[model samples]
Target: MTEVLVVGAGPVGLALAADLRMRGVEVAVVERRTDPGAGTRAIGIHSPALALLEASGATDGIRERAVRIARGEARADGRVLAEIRFDRLRARHPYVAALPQSDTIEVLTALAPPVRRGVGVTSLRQETDGIRAQLDDGGEIRAGVVVVATGWSGRDLVYRPGAVRTHHYPDRYVMADVVASGGPVARVHLERAGVVESFPLPGGRRRLVAWAGTNEVTDADGFLRDAVAARTGTPVDIAGASTFGVRRAVAPALRRGRVIVVGDAAHEVSPIGGQGMNLGLLDALTLAPLLGPWVRRGDDAGLARWERDRLASARHAARLAFLNTMLGRAAGPSAHAARTMALRTALRGPGGEAFTRAYAMRFDRAARARG
Candidate 1:
């Protein structure tokens, strides 16, 4: 029997399968699409994720192709509000690594088993011993556990009705990656209109994002250039751009009998803070070791603990993403000033280090230790 049958071959699924194989667990991965590596959707991999990814030996490859963001700045109205240094974060990798999602997938794919592309799990049925999965290509897979990592696209089919709750935000934004010179730092400009964020990528390129304040955008390149110049006084030569809205979704439970859920399938958060993908990667990292033992020995205790702790971590990440989204929206002068003050206080002295650790997603580590 296959120890673990991963239902999606995305980053999360690949990471989980890779780590499980490293631990000598039998695993198989299936993807619904033949090609899932098309976009640069997520770009920031915090220290916690980097540290967790070290087990699969993909962290070094990722870092080699990523820009290490050592610090971040918060500015508003042409004045510096606060500077948070990531070097102070207590982790093996003390910086946020910025790389296109495509690059990240490539690195992990090299380490994972051959993914069965163009194959999908149409349905899952629990058995007395193992779970049986029906594939879209008239095939079947029987495994000790089925992990749903198909992300938001597979939420409806993998989860029961009323199982997952979703909340959509009114905020809209446009972002693009272009050839530009930038340092190893990230910037968040809290303008009177909205927040403008810029991050350094590999190959001397930079990713720029600007909030649109619920307005429909027709010209992405024009809007990105105008917003960056207007808010941050930086002229950006954008080759192209894409617009996206934000939302938060979470399932109260991550496990249902022999079937389990991970990544965006279990919890989907806003992209403002760049925690959604990292949370999912960390999910795979945290679950791999526990899942192996359960699959081999039927040790349900570890899986129980894993579900409880993962749910707590997902909730905390969602709350953090919510705060980040709210803070980036358009604000008045007084509100901006208050936000700056709060940021300044939080990003100073001892609190600065603590905030950096929190932003690096050390809460999961702390929770695991406490558990």
Candidate 2:
């Protein structure tokens, strides 16, 4: 039996596998994708998340590939609502960095020992000794533990037996690419018409996620022309585009006997704070220290402990996401006015500084990992 079997080759799966191997646990990563990769997807390496990456000793190269977003500003009608000065966050890295998830998955996956691609786990059954995973072709894997880091639809289908929150909104969040003509880092500009967020890419291209203006990628050439003209004040080419339904969800239990779920498989954070991936990475990192010894020593109690420890953290992330998405969809006159006032208050004196620290995710004395 393998020490651990990791499902999915996404950021969280790759990260969990790498961390386990680094700690001397034998691991096998199973990814059904013929070739797993993402394009123009999430890569906001927030400070707190970056600190976790640093601990893994795998962040330096990824850091170099990312553009430092030392501040995050929100604007409406081109008027500033809130600007978070990340320099004040209490950490060595006090800012957000933008790197595509594709690059992130590649970097983290390459760090793992190896991957079992093309093979898929169809169902999970807990046994007295370990857990049995039935694969697509009726093959099976018995492992001391399991890690589920699968993405949206897959997790929804696989983890339905667990606590499931099917939260969907009619508000379609359109994400596409556009050239950055302004400053570096990242910016979120909101107008009565819509919201537009721009992030710098490791490559020359600048990525834009917008909810307003003419939707592009609906038609490649036409979308490119429309999106480019909208963002850079000139027509631009389409690098990539994808639309997804984002929401909050948590597996009923972080663990069921020897079977375990972490990352998006356990819970999903909405895209508002860009915390989904960040929180998922934290899940992997946090589990390593807490569960490593158990996997190494082959102790069932250790596996049990991992389940209990991961529950609270996953739940908090899911709830926070639910609230953020709820607020992001509301842009009525009153909500906008209230938001403006709140931003102004949070930007002044000590309040602003405190808010900035929180925004940067530098929660002082707050333990982000398992105790």
Best by lDDT: 1
Clashing pairs in 1: none
TM-score, cand. 1: 0.96
The sequence of per-residue lDDT tens digits that candidate 2 reaches over residues 201-274 is 76566776555332323554454446435643545565556555566666667766666677777777667657
lDDT of every predicted structure (CA atoms): 0.85, 0.67
lDDT per residue, candidate 1, 1-371, as tens digits?
Answer: 79899988878998898888888889999998999767788999888778778888989899899999989988888887778778866567778999999998999899888899999878898998889999989999999998889998877656778778899999999999988776888988988889998899888888898899897799999999999989988787986799999988989888888888899999989899889988898778888888877887888787777787788888888998898888898888898778888877777667777766667787774323411
TM-scores of the models, in the given order?
0.96, 0.85
* CA shift of 86, model 1, Å: 0.8
Per-prediction tally of clashes? 0, 1
Runs of candidate 1 exceeding 4 Å displacement: 366-371
RMSD of 2: 3.6
